[model samples]
Target: MADRSLESEQSWKALDGEQMSALLRGSLNDYGAPPAASAEASERFRLQLEQSDQDPMDAFVEAVAGLTDAVERLAEIAAKDPLAAAASIDPSAADYAEIESLPKPIRMTVRTWLGRLLVRSRLYDEALPVIAEVDATESIDPASSLFYRGACYHALLMKQEALTDLRTLLENEDDCPIRFSRLAKLMVADIKPLKEDSLDEISRLMTDVTRRLDLGRSDEKVEGQEQKIIDKLTKLIDKLEEQQQQQQQQQQGGGSSGGDPKNGQESPMQDSQIAGGSGDGNVKKKNLGDDDGWGNLPPAERKEALQKISRDLPTHYRDAIEAYFRKRATDG
Candidate 1:
């Protein structure tokens, strides 16, 4: 009896390999889960990373990074959707839960991300308190702050105030947001318009680029980038020319033959385009690279960032990116 008891008491130290793999099989096969594929792929990549001898870490990092990145992207998307936001909330009352449970910096990071999400969702007023709280405690970029204020003003229909803020952005800003600059110009253009010289200038820029491309220089690296630049210029010229033609046609037809002032007008944003050396926040700031964000960056760094993002984007997207980012002076 004692010997039998001893045999029964022996430690079971091993797990079956089949069982280990089977345990995860369900999670692996969850075809509905977008995240599972990436997560499992990363796990496989990590295993490979562990076994390889040379340069394994590099491959491991490159491969497995997608798992975390996918999740992060999901998080950002969640932040934008009201349903997602509601789902993430604990639903508990705000019973003085101390944010300081984590380190102060980590807590601040959470608030900042939340604030950014709120901004994107157009919950401008709701976002103000959190952003203001952070700004009170820590330095943020003035431009980012200004942008937030401008967005709020625009949403609230404070057009003149928004315009003032935007013009302030234009004047005090040496390098501005390309998207914002373009939108502002478009809005202002609706009220005023390009001078004949301005139209000629745009035409001349495109002509110069076309000449270069025709000279067998288009395939060169510098020429390719230049071609991209010129493509943007040509689009602008085409639009401006169309507008010029319409204006001439209108004169001949005696002011659209008594049509309403707004009837058949060019889209308020159609003519003007992005400026050179504008802020990058308009395109890749959130998508790639990082910005401490508007109102949180230093003046010099903000100007530098604006300069970098002033790329000649595709014509179709120039105005959309602008309106999406900042309120224009007149339209705000």
Candidate 2:
């Protein structure tokens, strides 16, 4: 809900090169090398390499494709062998210079897979530069690159930069994978408070509440409460802006006879109270849904009804409703 100018203001700026390099080097040293490939993986790679004799690039692509699959297979074996999945694909085994020399498309693919593997393994700092590299090239699954870069920025405590990237993904990449968009919104919500973008945060929450209501995925009582909060915040912002305009006018009229508060002028606080007090009770009653059906439901009956309906709702929505009730219970 930020205006276009605000959105433009949030554009991403890369971290300082020297600082980023130092951080990556430190993280890599701390993490050390990835565990060597398990025996099964080694044999599979050997066979894959043999098959690639006709085309080395094809073999490399095959190896990259199998990387995640190999980890999953190792995990299955580890369930029984206890040590079978202890090893991971070591990224250092790849010759960076040789990969750099490959065709553009193939090189980008390798970097993309490598970046993803590093991120999945929680080597966020190491993944940061790799993701940035791909992002610079504007190739190799750009959506994934942006997501992982935002994640890396988040992990590194570069929250402003993280918000910039995550917001970009959320706003501009509708065709991006759903999971990435969802995760970006969650991260934005989490980071907004820290950045003091309270209005923007509230706007996002309101948007989400409205969307759920449209989708029939919200509890009536919860939806009403969220709407009430939105209304209250909107009113509050309007009131503050009015006060600001009055102050600015007074400043401009400082040399005029009526400008001085000391000259029998009313205090702004008193003026605001006089203007607002008459409507406060009415606003509160409306927000509390004094005449709404959901507000009239008995607590026990409401809980029972919600539980009965939950079985038919999607898992995500059901979880959201449950969480809402839990929070309300705790708040009460």
Q: Who wins the lDDT comparison? A: 2
Quote the lDDT for 140 in model 1: 18
Clashes of each: 13, 0
Tell how far residue 313 is off in model 1, in angstroms.
35
RMSD of each: 28.7, 17.3
My TM-score estimates for the predictions, one after another, are 0.25, 0.33
Return the top candidate by TM-score.
2
Error of 2 at 52 (Å): 22
Whole-structure CA lDDT of model 1: 0.42
Give the per-residue lDDT of model 2 (tens digit) for 1-332: 74676446433333322332333233223323233432333344445545545322233345433444432343344346422222222234333343444445434544555555656655554566555565423233456557877877765546788987787776554456788888888888877665332444444455446545664565775567585644545454445445555655687676453434787664445334435444445533335444665423355744555566456756664555555556657868
* Candidate 1 worst ten-residue window by lDDT: 11-20
